[model samples]
Each structure stands twice: as C-alpha cells, then as structure tokens.
Target: MSSRSLPTRQLATVLFTDVVDSTRQLAQSGDQVWARLLDALDAVSRSEVRRRGGELVKSTGDGALMLLPSPTAAIECATALHAAAGQLGVTLRIGAHTGEVERRGLDVAGMAVHVAARLMGSAGSGETVVSATVQALASPAAETYDDRGELSLKGVPVPVHAFAIRQASPPPVASAPLPVGDDRDAVTRLLRERRYEEAAEIAPEVDAATLAEALLAAGGRVEFLDVDITLVRMLQDVLDRLPADDAVTRSRTAAKLAFELRGDPSTAQDRRDLLDLATQLAESAGDAQAASEALLATVNSLWEPTGALDRLSAAERVITLTRRTNDVDHELEARLARLHALVEVWRIHDAGLELATYARLAARLDRPELNVFVASRRGMLAQISGRYDEQARQGEIAYTNAVAAGMPDAERLRMSHLFPIERDCGTGPDLFEAGLEMLRELTGIMPGNFYEADVAWVLLTLGRRDEARTELARALPPLLTSSGYRWLFSAVLAAETTAEVGSAEACQRLYDALLPHQDLLACVGPTFGGGVGERLGLLALRLGRTDEALERLARAVGDFDEIAALPWATRARVHLASALRSAGDIEGADSRLAEAKDTARALGMARMLAQIEAEDGGR
Candidate 1:
C-alpha cells in the first residue's frame, strides 16, 4: 500500500533532545552518579513535555524523542527544557521539525524522525535548532530566529534549511490577588483607566452594583470584543459572587456576560442560562428595558435554543418591551434581530421589508457601523433573491464600509460576507487552481479552525478528493462535536464535502451532528444563501437513511421555494430527484428532475444545470 493510504500517518511536530557530552560526564562522574543524573533529566523531560501537551515518545539514555501537536508547541517545550537544563547544571542540544510521521503503536517513523535526529547533531551545546518547516509554522507564533542557512544532512535526499531559536520565552505573569473586602473604588479606578484585565482580576471582590458598572465600562472597549478565556473566568467568578437580591445589577451583569460567551461553542448552554437568569431578574424588578436587553441578547445568540422560530418569539418580546420603555436603540436592535430570524425561517419577503426599515432607522441614527451592518444584510438578501450582480455589489459596499469604519475584524468579516459570493459570481481567484497554501494566505487573517471546512469544500468541488478527504478528517470532528457561532456554516460546508469524500464513520458523525439543526438555514450570521436541511438530506442519503433523506430534501425544497432562493431550490430538487430515483419512485423522480432543470436553466446556474443533466450518469 502507498504511504498515502496509511491512516496512522499524519502531519506532526517531532522533537529530539540530547544532554551535552553525556559520555564524558559518565566517565568523569561514577556510574551511580551518572545514573542518578539521568533520572533527574528524565523527571524534568516528562514534566515539561506533558505540560506543553506533547507526548514523550521514549528516553534514549542520554536524550529523548517527543511529538508535539504543533511546531509552536514543540518550540515552547524545547525552550522550556533548555531553561530547566540550566537549573540541573547541564547543557543540552535540541532540534524540532514538522512533517508527516507514521505512528507505530509506541514509536513514530518516516523522514521527519531522521531529519529531526540530524538536526540535533548539528545543534551546538545549549542551543535549539529547527527545520525550515518548523520555522515557517512557528514564526507567525511570535518567536524570533537566527537564520543558519542551508546544510547537507546524512541520508537526506536534498539540502535542508535550518534556523536557531533566538528569543527566550517570557516569564509567566502572576496576577496579584484582590483585597479581602469589597473594592468597588479600586475596580472603578482600574476600569476608567482602561486596565480592564487588571480590573477583571478584582471584579469578584466588588458588590453587584460595581460589577454592573464595570461590565458597562468594559463592554465599550474593543479589547473585550475578542475571546479572552482568563477574562471570561474572572467575570464568571464575579457573577457567582453577586447577591440574587440585587436584581437590576445582576440582570445587567448576566446579560453582559452572555454577550462575552456568544461565539464560543463550549459556553452555549451557559449563555442560554445566563440570558434566562437576566430576563427573570429584570422582569421581577419591573425593569422593562433591562428585560428587553436580555431577551435581545438571546435573539442575537449564535446558536439558537429552539432554532429560528424561537428567536422570532424572543425578538417579538424584545420589541414589545422596547416599545413600552421608549428605548429606540433596543427597538432597532430587536428589529434587526427579527429580520435575520425571518430569513432563517425562510420568510424572505418579510425579511426584505425588515431590512428596508432597518436601513432607514440606521440612516436616521447616522451610525456608520450600523450602516455597514445594513449593507451586509442587504448582500444576503440579494444572494437569496438570485441577484448575483447585486449580491456582489452589496458585498463590496459592506467590505469597503467595514474597512473605512476601522472594524477590528474587517478582513475576517470579508470571509463571511464576500468570500463565498465571490466563488459563485466568478469574480474572484479560481479556488480550484489556487492551492491550499494560497488559500491559507488569503484567510490567514481569520483566527480559528472553522475556515478549514471552507477550504475543504473548495477542494471537493475542484475534484481533489484526496486532499478534500484529508482536510475533512481534520476539520469535521470539532465542528461536529462543538457548538459555536460559526457552527452552521462550518457544519453545512463539512457535510457537503463529507458527502462527496468522507469515510463511513465521518459521514455518520456529520449526519448526527447536523440532524438537530436541519430546519435552520445553513448561514454564518446573514451570509449562507439557504437551508442546511439540504446538506443534512444529502448526508442521510449517503448513510442509506432513505426515508429521512427524502424528508429532509423535500422540506429543503419547500423552504427555498418559500424564500425564492432559486439557486438552492434547483440544487435541492436535483438531489431530491436522485434520492427518489434510488428509492424506486420513478414518477416522483422524473417530476423533480424536470422542475430542477427548468429552475437551473432560468437562474443561469450552469454548473447545477450540468449536474441535473448528468444525474443518471453520476453527480
């Protein structure tokens, strides 16, 4: 079998370490002392490797071999070991490299091992050297290097480029504990000075009112916009310390905390519970505006509890409360939330009208940020409405406006608003020919592994089945098992790719993950053009769940038809027809196929039309 067919082989970082002049040390020191020293080295090596989430493969008397999850992790572990060696009164040489390694139960093999071994030989005492691949992956992780140029290595087919790590890892910062009593004054002072991280450390020591005030202050800062795990823990501690009697303050704090947890899949249930607590607190205190704000957060949650219909109800409640309290901002926020829900539920025409109202209100408010948001939603509307040119134009407007407004996520946001549209509109680079490295470079600005599924989809579409399957294997597990803001887009895209190239186990896993969300549109914020039910249907068909497949596909067809999403409707009909044919419903199959052909032709979906024509041959 080819090396490519071996499932155990995968990309990984390999590290090799050696104690300098071990032979001389053993000769000078006695055998017993040298043995004791080896024990000490082994103790330190095990601790450091496990601390950095690396595997200590084996000890080689004078040194050891290790495997790490990434080149950055390997570099970290190597540097840490270097520091520890100094404390042990010994010098060491280490080399780390990243490449394909085949696991053989307890040990790893292949070219990466040999390269790493050679790299260790070339390293000077107390130095850490790494291969070019490791340097490339680790450089972006914020480490400086000294270029060692190229060298010929023993048993290597070509010359290898190497680099020596120059920068030492910074000492971990220890946060000072807060005072024993309430430190509201200290918290307020820190927040006002924009030292939010410091303030968060002491947030739990403050009373409910002070915590609420800190929340509002921190909410306005761009630093708090991104996920900070430490900050999240600090805020959760603060909420836990607050008294339940202080309904108003607790309500606001809980609502704010829910926003902080919005995009994370691990906090999905926590976010729902927090919003519920906030809503109940506000209603009990007779604070309509606060209650409205809490419900609005729920409406805007990345993962809905009961899907779009539930959000619609929450949005309506927000609207009712906003009207009672005369809160224009909450009212507008609720309306926009409702608009997105409408689209998600396949009420496209209603969503369009809601968009018009939102645009007018945004202009009246004269908020450039809100206008940029409106432009993005307009792009979604154009996409589902089958106005490809208009979709492209609106996407550009949103992208340009976001950049001009200096949004922190301007480049990342372009991935959501314009990347998929560009692919379909033929106005962007040929993704099929662009290759994975260029794709990574294009999306490098976007932080997270979710884009891996997006790249996999392009590979699958371009007929690179092996590459697509490899990426799908890497990207599917997390998306299938976790819940997050981008869950819909990532899961649907993975499902589509998986149906084409996935193994049986992967297909089953994706089908299970997506089944619960089958009724909602496969969207990221407002971007995906239509129903995820279609992808779910395709997965069901692949898994041989015939009845479920037909049910899902037929439901998707109705949804796209309801929204006038002609392109998606055409695609779903084709798939549905294929499923029907397999189920031996010949008449039903012919009817669906003819309808799909008509719609695909009308919408100028050339690729989809070709797919319909080739349904009997193979899709």
Candidate 2:
C-alpha cells in the first residue's frame, strides 16, 4: 500500500500550503535548527487552524493538512496559518480546494487533493493559492484576492485564473512572470491559471501609447459602479501628478472614468471626486464637449435633498466652471448660464420680493425657460411659506408654460407643487388633482432619475404615504435607482408612512440606512423636509441612540436657519431640546424649548406651538 493512497470523507474547503526552498533552508541550517523550525510550525499551525474554525487533518512530517467549511473560512484560515509560522523562516504557501472528499481512517483524499497539491507546487513560499471556483463563491462581499490571470499546469488539460489572498502588504515574492499575449484558443487554460502581479507589470510595458484608445475602450468594459469610481479616482490622481500638456488623453481618460462613476449610488466623496476630476480633466483637455458633460455631471450630483443645502456650492461651482472655459457659446452652456443667473438672484428671500426681481430679469432676458425655472422655485417658496395667493399665481405660470413648451415633467412637478397651495386658498383645486393624475402619465415618459421623489414629496405632505408608497414604487424607474439620495427616498417613505402604518421594523431599518447616508445630502427644495431630521432624531431617541438623535436634531436646526424654515425650525428645536434634557442638560434644554416657543409663535405655526406645549408639559 502506498503512503499517498489514503482516503478521507468530509465536506470541506480542501487547502494546500507549501514552504519554498525547504531543502535549501535545511542545507543552510543544521539538522537541529530545521527540526526546531518544523516543531514551531506544527504548534503555530494547530493554534491558528482552531482559531479559524478549521481542523488539522494530518501532518505529513513537513506539510500539514487542514479543512474548513466555506471558501471564505478556508482563506481566512490559510491567511492566519501563514502569519503564525512566518518568524521561523517557514514560509507557508497554501492552496485551498473545497469539495466532498472521501475519508479513510485518519486520512482525507479526493480528486481535489491532487489539484490542491499541484496548486501548492505553483505558488512560491509565503503565498496562498485559490481556485477560480472558490473566487466565484466569494463574489462582492468578501474583501480579499488578487487575480493571477492565467497559467497552464502539468496534467491539468485546462488553464485557470488563480488568486492570492491580499494583505495590507503581501510578502516579498520571487517567482516566474506569466508570459505575455493570451491566446484566444486557451479559454479553459486561462480560467485555470494565474499570472497576477506579472499582468499588472506587463500591462504598462504593452506600449499603451500605441493602443491608448483601444486600451481605454477595453478598460471601459469595466462597468461596475464601484470599480469605475476607483479607476476614475486613480486616473485623476495620475493625471494630476503629471505635468500639464504631457498627455491630453490622460485627462480624457480621467473624465471618462469619473463621469461613469458619478452615475452610481456611491459615496458622496466618490460622486464629488468624480465630478471634480471630470471638471479638471475637461479644463486640461481644452475640450468643450468634455467640459459641458462634466459640468452637467456636477449638476446632476447636486439635485438631492440638501437636508443642508451644501451642494448648492457645487452647483455654483459649475457656474464658475462655465465661466473659465473659452467656449461660452457651447450649445450645452445654457443650463450653467441659467443656473448662475438663478443663484445670483433666487435664493431664500421673501417670495413676493424674489418674484418681482425674477419677473424683471425674465422680461429683461426675454427667456421663457429662465422665467419658468425662477417662477417655479419662488412659487414653491410662497406655498411653503403659506403665502397662498402668490403661490397660486406662480404655479399657474410655471405649469402653463411647461405645457406650452412641451416640458411635461416640469409641468407635472409645477402642478404638483401647486395643489396643496390651491387646497389651502380654496382655488383651482380640481386642476391640481388633475395635474397629479397627469403626472402619473408623465412619470413614464420622463428620461431621468426620481422625478418621482419630487412627486412623492407632495404626496407625503398630502398625508398620502400609502398611496405615495404605491406611486413611488411605480415612479422610481431604473434610471432613478442611480438617483441621488435614493436611500433618502426610502427613508422618507418610512418617515412619512410609519406613523400611520405602525411598522416599527420598516421605520427602524429605514432610519438605520438613512442615518449613514445623511451626512452628505444637500437639500435644494424650498420645503421644511429638512426638519424631517427632528422627526428622524426623535425616532432614534426612542430607539436609544440619544446622543446620535441629539446631534442630528441640532444639524436640522442649521438647515432650517439657512432656509428660514422658522416654523419647522422651531419644531426641530423643541425636539432637540427635549432630547438634550433627556440626555441630562436641563438648563440648556429649557432655554432651547423657550426659544422654540417664541419662534413658533412669531412664525404662526399653531401646530408647532401645541407640540412645544406637549413637550414642556412632559418635562
């Protein structure tokens, strides 16, 4: 009977680890030193194997075998095993293969057994090898692996894309480089082997200069939002480090990558980074087309609930970007020109005053589009301020022109904003409702993100969370999944509906998701949805994250102050004050509560006054 002829049966991720140059190390050190090193390794491997939910199967005198349940668990085990034996110069190389194996006596064996041993032969010391099958099982959530493109193995008729588990710093490597130029006929062979670090080295040597655009086009084939973002940022940093005029294509690449990344529901830093890179790239390229696209990309990132309105600075930066370019007459320059015009004149002053200035400017410019945009924002300011009559008039103009101009999305939104004001003032009431039904049709035709978040805001205010949730589900089309504050839409859905539906679970999950994403939202609306922070904070307080609740509620006050949402501001202050009191600062809390009552009274928010009274009474 052969010593290798043993078999063991178990469900496991089969693993292979080998130390490189073991015979040479033995030749350099005496027998006693080698024996002690082997003893140290056995002890280290045993402890680490147990720590990683692995069991030591058997010791092969020098190499030991281990088993673990999942590929992730196996990789984790192997990483720990490699570290534990590092100090003794016993450089451990491991290959993991997971499958059903036959068990006989104390030994384990299967077809994967040969494969794992063969893979271990391929790896240098201080390395771990994993198969492509294992990589597929780890997908997006598992945080480690460096692709070693493809390699051919002895007795394996097929090739494979192998991998090494990555660390913050990998061990120093001495290994053969993978040969260049992958043959199309070797797809199976490619799938079975890896030339990981070699490919990255060979990539730069490929004279990308000769095939720049083709390489870019190939790179563009990478479409995952997160991956594109990382590539874009790297491209940006690379371009920035190089002297200007060194290569125009570098900036173009940066712009392309950044623009693509911005389309993801990624981090604000990611979106903002991409936009900034795109703008800088455009400036570098001296290309009008790229500049216009980058500017629009920047604007697109800003159309979310500012809950703080900080992104208005970004929108304003686009205006500044528009001015820096030589191509002021670029066909796509209109949006920036209009945005700059609005920013110069149409922030949060009194609606009546802003309207007169907007009306004068529209007449001076003789532009209907400018008139519609400015009139709509001012009118929204009026309605939320409860200046009912002025709200009605601007709503009429914005909706009427949008219809005449064939801007149905704008028309639907304008009419939607008008409805509550009409209901309040007892005028054009049916028209607003008719406009909403019309919006359901418009939602299907609009070619953009979350035109429905806009529609839902009105629906939420109308006390229609159930109906709004249904419409919102319908309204949030594929394009809108990439929309800014998408997480906020779901949060608003819970915040708006939870009080009525009594679903604590939905509200809690919604709150949890929203709180993390909230740090970067910059609201652009004229509504006190910013005050929704107080509502959310109060919920968090009930959930026992009182410190978080207090911090969030205070931030809400800052947004309210900027937008002059006094009534909502006062309401937010009361909630925050109550939270502060609950958190043990009684004097500070009392002063805030008093100030809230005064502001709510002056702003004529009887609802807020009643709420403050209840809070004070509770205390």
Residue 607, candidate 1: how far off, in angstroms? Answer: 1.8
What TM-score fits each model?
0.60, 0.45
Q: Write the per-residue lDDT of candidate 2 for residues 1-619, one digit (tens) a residue.
A: 0011111123356776666678888889975566556655655665566665666654444666777656666666666667655656567878776544543222345445555666777776677777765666543323567887675655433455577766623222221221222222121111112222323333333333322332232222111223333334444444444455643565445544443444444444664665577567666777655665555544444433431233334434544555566333222233322332233232445334534543554465433444555556666666545555666687777667644432313444465565544443332335645655664544454223244544554465455667766654554343223443233433443454443343455447546545544543222332213334555776677666889888888987776677665554665787789789889998888999899888766655555566678878887
What is the lDDT for 176 in model 1? Answer: 24
C-alpha RMSD for every candidate: 15.7, 23.7
Top candidate (TM-score):
1
For model 1, residues 339-448, the per-residue Cα lDDT tens digits are: 86776676778888988987887688634456566777887888786777777677778778755543323444455655555444443346345444434544343334
Clash list (residue pairs), candidate 1: 265-483
Worst 10 residues of 1 by lDDT: 1-10
Clash count, candidate 2? 32
Quick one: best lDDT, which candidate?
A: 1
